[model samples]
Each structure stands twice: as C-alpha cells, then as structure tokens.
Target: MGNLLGNWRFKEPSTVEECDSTWGSDSESDEPAAEDDSGISESVSPAESEWPPGNNGDLSPKLTDSPEFLPKMKRSFYAARDLYKYRHCYPNYKKSRQPNEYRNLRFYLNKIPLVPDGIYIEEILTRWRGDYDKLEHNHTYIQWLFPLREQGLNFYAHELTQDEIKEFQSTREAKRRFLAAYSLMLDFYGIKLLDKSGNVARSSKWQERFHHLNESQHNYLRITRILKSLGELGYEAFKAPLVRLFLEESLHRNTLPNMQHSILEYFVYTIRRPAARRHLLRYARQHYKPAHAFLWGPPPKRSKPKSGDVGASVGAGSSGIRAPAPTPEPQRRGGETSFIPASGCSGTLVSYHDATVCQDVDAESLNAYTPLGSSMDGPEGVFMMILERNNYSGAVPL
Candidate 1:
C-alpha cells in the first residue's frame, strides 16, 4: 500500500511539495539564486527580471539603499499593472483640447500669404452696412467689421468723402441716416474734418452748433452724444478745447451736481489714454472744486447724528431738526445708477445697465466658413479636410 501511495503522489501531485518534487528540481537549477557576501538572498536586478526601465528611471537615485526607492518601485509596479489592465478603457484619450476646425481656420487666417487685392472698398462698405440681407446678414456683417477694422481696412471712415461732408453740413435732407453713420464713423476714427484748403473746419462748426442748440434748449442729447464720442476717441488736437468746454459746463452753478459728476466720470473712465486723462485732471483741479472733491475725497459722511442723540429715543416732533427722513435709497434703475444728463432729459439718459452689449463670439462659430475667407478656395478645402479628419459631425450652416 505504501509503494502504491508514493507512486500515486509522484504521478498526481496532490500537495505543493509533491508537485515541486514531480516537476521542479531539488538541485541542478537552470538559473542560480543570487546571494550577497553576507549570505542573504538578493532581489533580481531589473534587467534580470526582464522589466524595461521606464523613461523616469534615469532621474531616480542610483543607490539601492535609498529610502525613496521602495515607494517608487511600488508606484511603478501598480502603475504598470493598472495600465495593462485598463489599456482598452481610453481609446481616444489623446486629443487636443481645442477643436481641429478652429485650429485650421486660425492657422489659415493668420498665415495667409496675401490678402487679395480683389477685396475692393465698395464690397467692404456693403458688408459693413449689411446691404446684402438685413435680418440674416446684419449680425454676420457686424462681426466682419471688427476683423476688417483690425486688418486696418478703415472701411467705415473710408466711405465718407469731402464732397459728402460738405453736402451733409449744408443740406438738411442729405440723408439723416447717412449723416448719423458718417458722424459716428468719423468720431470713432478721430478724423478731424478738413476743408478744401486742408484747414480744421469741423471744430468751430461743432462748437457753434453746440452753443446755438444750447440757446434753443433743443438737440442737447445729440450734442452730448457727439461730445461723448469726441471724448472717447481722444482726438489729441481736440483735448484742450474739450477740456475747456467740460470745465465751463461742469463748473456752472446752475449745472446739477449729478450732471457734473457724470461728466467727470466720463473723462476719468472713458478717455483712457494718458494725455486725455492728464488734460481732464489739470483743468478739473483748477476750475471745479466739486469735481475735485468727488474724485479725491472720501464720500461725504452721512450727516452724523449729534453725540447727545446717540442713545436717545425721540418723538416725531423732536426739538433738534431731525434729519429729513433719510430719502429712501433710489431704487437702482436696471441694476445701475442712471446718470441724469446736463439738460435734465431723464428720458434720454443712457443706461449702462446691460453690461454685455457686445458678447464674446463662440470660438466654434467664428471659425466656421464665412464670406470673407470662403473666397479662398485652398484654405476652404483644407479647413473641410481638417474638420473630417477630426471626425467632426456638426452641421456648418455657412
């Protein structure tokens, strides 16, 4: 029975020891176990372990006795195991955050060899005015204007001729819309109106118009609008004249303090350039005490209650002139203080309540094919190819 059991163990190997004896050798091993001089078993070297050294291996400490090595080795082992186990989880993991469509369009626009001479002034004007289709193309046309302006086309201002300006000045029916558009464009570009002999003509005419309109108590809103545009443009030559006008108007005793405050705020905030700022500041210091106080001083302390009245309760008919019931704070108009204009035209006062008048265009939308760049056949094809390569499935309704 002992002989039979021993033979069965050799053949079937029920225990680990029996299995080792059956297959593994007790001596004459293919690879010998390594030992240190102290007779301690040593770990297999990475090379002997058949593990490829990772890219970061060169940055690791060479010393086998390093305290950091154990943690690093464990991390590497787990990372490798995880990577192997989950390799199929992220098939499309490596991709740029920015879409290829936008990248291609930006590249094409920025790297264009030449802006075609075929892009004429008339075409640019038509685009600016949204002359193609009023509803569908207006927003697109407006969007294109900024790019055109950035490219230094100056199409808006370029449309106005000396003849047109003269006609606009002399004729009441010379197209009010055109006149308004040209005025805005001229002011935006800081173009000083010049006469046939190249003399500055518009300054005196504008000043005379301002005085005449002021006397009639009419078109004050229009005048203020023009003044605001002129101030914002920071026409260098007009700085001194504007400063004088601002000081004279703002310092008048009859002018409401709120109007003065608005004017001062406009100068301080709107005209951003240094020269304009200094010009406004210099005159404001010399001529307007209220403006100076408003700009520099702490807000007027609310008329403080008397020290005697600190803890005292008073009846409705108190002896000390009770501060007229502090006027209930004016309900803010559309989340902003509406500035009353100098003319007290509350109706016409510009409300700065809507902060997002001009919003950022979506990068994806801007990168889509437009009339301006669609004319470029090569770039259009390349843009489409890039879109396809990126597996983009969105419809572009260009």
Candidate 2:
C-alpha cells in the first residue's frame, strides 16, 4: 500500500473544454471561495515566526471543522492516483495524435504559466484560461475532467440543500454526481467520520484492496477475476464479490479470532454516512445464521423389555427417546478478514479458519509462489493476485 502511494504522480487535467456545454450551462455568479492556507502556507518567513502563532491578518477563511471532511480530503488527495498513468497509457494504445493535436493539447495544458504555489485550482484557472480560451466544452473533455473536479465537489455537496443542489447543478450537475459517487467510495474505503471533537465517530473498515478497483494486486486479483468474468467491469463490479467473499469466509470458520472479527464489526456496526446507511444495513443483513442439516449413519435397533423393565411404560423401553434437539447456532455478525503478505511484506498469503471448527493451517506448511519479483512495495505485489504457490517469481511455502 505504501509502495502504491510512492509511485503515484499527481495529474493535472487537460484544459480542453467540451463543445457540448448544454448539461450545466449556467454562468458562474457566486464568488468562488478563496483557498484556505491557514494550516500550511507557501510563504512562511522564519524571522517573523512565533511558536504558537497569532493572526497575521484576516486572510484566513473560517473552515467548517466537520469530521466528515476527512474522507473528502482523503479522496481529493488520492484521486490523482491514476491520472498520470492513465494519460500516458491511453495515448499509446488508443491512437496516435498528430503533431498539431499534441501542440493544441500542450497549449490547453498551459506548458508555460505563472501558477502561484499556494493556490491549487484558482492558480491553474487564472494562468491557463488565456491558453484555454478558445477550447470547446465537449463531452469527451467533460468525461475526463469530471473525475478530477468530482473529488472536491463531492466533499462539499452533502451540506447543500435541494435549492443549492439545483443551483449548483445548473452549472455543475456532473460535478455533483461525481461527488456523490466519490463519497460512497470513501465510505467503503473505511475512512472514519469525525465530530467537532475530532474523535472517530466511525472508522474506515474496508480493506484497501476492495476500494482500489484499478490496481492489480494479490488480494484484489480475486475480485478482478470475478469482475472480468462479468464483462464491462468498473467500480460497481466489486460490490458482489466483496460481499460474497466475506460470507463464505465467515461461515467457514467456527469462531473468528483476532482483530479480524473487528474488521466486519466496524464495517457493519458503524454508521458513517446518513444517506447510504440503509444500503449498508440491508447488504450486511444477508450474512451468517444456522439452518438444519440431516444426520445420517447407523440405525438404532429396538431393545426388548426385560423382566425388571415390566414396571416401565410400554413404549419407554421399546421406542427411541426423543431428547431435546440441538438448536441451530446463530451466525456471527460479520466475516471479513485482514490480508497479510505471505512472504516479505509483499507475498500474498491468505488463510481462513475457525480453530474450533477445524485444524488451523500453519503458514510454514502452506505453498508459496513468487513471480514477477515484485517487492512488497512494488505495483505487482501490492495490486495483483497470486493464488497458488506456482504463480509467483520463486517457490515458497505458503
């Protein structure tokens, strides 16, 4: 996971605006909120610094300290995870662009612009608008840029009212949808919601593998396999696989051990978002509970009454006794487990067991496969799957 982070290069979107600007065509009127830099500023001078710090001026905008903001921050931070790679990969495989086309792209990207260090979107907008002025706001352009802008807008839309949604949607409806989807993704990733006090009102409980649908890694490979089988895979394809995997794993164990139990607990037990709370509850309700199973083996023979058994009731000795039948066991509340690397910090080793239900499998006795020589921190190791021992770069015991 850490390796995945290091390899990430932030992408700046191409300045191509779509020609089909009909969707959210309203003009911008509200003053764009000024960028907040109180926490960390680009221009801090050592000579004027104070330890605890005091107000330099009224430059700081009051920010809502809502705990819900953390996931937004996280999403905005991580959204760039695929931008650079996607930009590079697409041009090579899809089609070759003409030289002028490339020049047009570079112009839109503002290859030369005086962007201020502290400002993010505002700085980019200010410097690049000149180069971007003649560009059309086309559908293709929207599809690409929407994902980038969605991260920030999604974080802010929850606070909006119906009127605000309508007003905002007039110019940025796609932006709103992007935010809605992003918020769902962030919740699934297990980032906790906070209150004013900064306590964990809810903690993120989903594994990183489940949330990162794009990356290839051992834990995610199973999910991807299932997804590709379904055809036309996307983020939504992971939902069923994730749910079913948890169910099967939970039922296989007689008793869940370790913090593994808490993984499911946090996922099911916590309420991080108000709107999707019902959806999560409904999905979680389908897991774990006992049902009757037929017992089959040798049949019992009827015993004949002896001389002393005459005092007993006629059927007592002859008939089989019907003791109270065993009641079915209730299912565990959740079945999720944490994944650990089989070898080094990168090899994939997966084991599910309920020690009381069956014998525990030792890691040493398990088979291992090392392929691709991916370091624990490498992309292949972190994002792809290795199910069997022969699948890896080297032979290893599971």
Candidate 3:
C-alpha cells in the first residue's frame, strides 16, 4: 500500500500509490475509447488508479492513523528488498527465500495477536467489536486477523493454500476463530451475519457504521480484500450480497460517493446473473472512471477460416478472467423457476451471485424486472419467469 521503486509492480490489494502511475502507459496510450451499452464514451476498464483520498470531499485524507512504526516498517521492508533485488546487475539471479514468521496462516489461530499491543482476533470480535476508533485506525492487524487464500501486500502473511484451508476447516477452534473474524469485519462494514438463516442483513447500525466507513481513507481497500477473502475461504455464499449492498448503496441510494471505482472493478462481475450484471453495469458506466483498455479492451474481431484452422480472438473475451455463466441457457422453459438466496440474501436479490429467499424478490414487485419473460402472467411469480430465461437451478443455503 506504499510507494515502490524500479518497474512498478503494485500488488492487487495495494493502496492508491499503485494507481498513481499516470494513465497512458504504453499499453493504453494508443487504445481507442468506445461507448458501453450505456452510451457513455470511454474505453471500458476499471478505474485507472485509486486516487488518494484528498481529491474527493467525501473522503478527506487522514494525515495520521497507522502507528508511526507501521509505515516505518513498510518503508524499511521495501528498501531492504531493493538492496537485495539487484535488478539490473542480476536480473535472473535467484535469492534464497527466507521464511517470514508472520507469513504462516495457522499462527493467527493461536491466542497471540499482531503488533506489540495488538488485540487478539477473539478480543477484536468481542470487546472491540463495536470500537470504531481502534478498528479504523489499526493497519497491520487486518491481514493477520482475517487470513485469505490470496496473498495481500502485507508481507507479514504468507500465501494461503488449499491445504491450509482444509486444515482450517478441520480444526474446530480455528474454524470458530475464522467465523468470528468474518463477523467482526462484516459488522464493521455495517452488515449482520444472521444466526438462524446464516444470511447477512443490514445492521441496525448501518447508517452510523456507513458514515464511519466514508470518513476513513483505507476502508474501501480493506473491504476489497475482505470480500476476496470471504469468497475464497468457504464463505463464498456471503460474498455476493455484501457486494450487492455496496452497489445498491452507491448506485441506487446515492449515499456512497467516490466508490464507483471499487464497486465496478471488484464487485459487479462476481454476480453470475447476466441480467443483474448488465443492469448494474449499464447504470454504473456513466458515473465510474473510464476503465483502462486492458480491463475492458475491445473484444477481438472474428477471423475467416483458412483450411481447417480457426483463428482466435483475444478481443472476443477469450482472454478475459470472467467465468462463463454456469447455466448459459435453459434446456427447458415454461417450467417453474425459483430465485432462492443463500444465507446472506435477505432484502437482496437471489442467485448464486448471492440472492436471497423469494420473499425479498416477491413476485408482486419483481414483475417490473426485465430479466423475466414479457408475459409475467403466472402465479409462479416474476423470478419464475426470470428463471425461464436461463438454465436456472436454485440457491442451496449453506
């Protein structure tokens, strides 16, 4: 989350410094701008770089928060890394890897916490559960507290492996700690993980919690990392709705400002529903930063067949990271289809994209939804009609 030297290689969860490299990098300099379906004219890509907080009045930069030591440690870490890197003289030289003690995923399951005076994950869950000041200010504790399958910029943690996940699940106490960690992060984001249904809902403190969220500089990045960790570490079902809530707040409620970049880049595509994705994308394009061509680069043009060979198109979405819709088309139609949301689906849409019970997607109100067939004529409801349009199964609540 800090500055780097040599060729810029910003980690995925890095801070705005990574985004500071000006646009028009060689790859994007000659790229053409095009209009999305929303009719907005711009190259389709995620935001160029996360602008540091000062630009937006909604988020004033916090001059101080992370204890002086954290940034000092980060600076020293980078400096030491460069000293040993010797990039120009020994580009191919391999340096012996030293095992970082803090890198271990299992270490957090123990009672100890990060930092000299940091609180344990359990304490963070209990005593600090509602403590905004401490939670907002803490920096290094996050990566250690909520471990992830993906390695973040925090050098303190190691790469999360599938084996580690299985080990985590098998250990009862560890599982409890991980679940508690989830609760702590969710509550901080103003969401409540329901006990009976195992779904997430708006917390009574959403308004207050949300205000605190906007007040801080780094919460969006934290939210980005947290969402990725949840989706990866077996809480996949809850991931979708948390994303939806942000999209709803920023796009619909107008309550969340300057968040268009995060929502579009990290949140929208996680939704597997074509209709919902398109609906949100179309509306969001106007407000969001023009995505880099690298992100929304042109779909490739089709090539004519030469002999038996077929030419591939990178621009045709062949090289994209997007997963194809699980059920791209329905084999059978005119049958009953349902939109049951998984655990985190209350008051939200239902689909593995993290939709909820039919109750929220009531047939009465869902009639206006365009994903459904035009008739909307049956008692089976609007979701039933929407499901007819795809190879729709249903959400199996976990």
Better structure of 1 and 2 per TM-score = 1
RMSD of each: 34.4, 27.3, 22.1
lDDT for each residue of candidate 3 in 14-100, tens digit (9 for 90 to 100): 322221111212132334322111000111111111112333331111233323211110111111122112111123232225543
Q: Tens digits of per-residue lDDT for model 2 on 1-398?
A: 99996566534333111101111222233222211100000111111101111154321112233322211110111111112212222222222233222221221233421121222222333443323221121112221122211111112111112232233334343333333333332243332323322122123343442233212122222222222211111232233333333433344442222222222322221122212223332333343221111111011234776678753434311111132211211112122222322443222222221101111224443333323333233111331222323222221100
Q: Rank the candidates by TM-score, best first.
A: 3, 1, 2
**lDDT for each candidate structure:** 0.26, 0.24, 0.42
Top candidate (TM-score): 3
Please provide, for model 1 over 227-279, each residue's C-alpha lDDT reduced to its tens digit, 9 standing for 90 to 100: 33332222223434443454555465323222333344333322323344444
List where candidate 2 sits over 4 angstroms from the true fold: 1-168, 172-272, 288-369, 372-398
By lDDT: ranked, best first:
3, 1, 2
Winner on TM-score (2 vs 3): 3
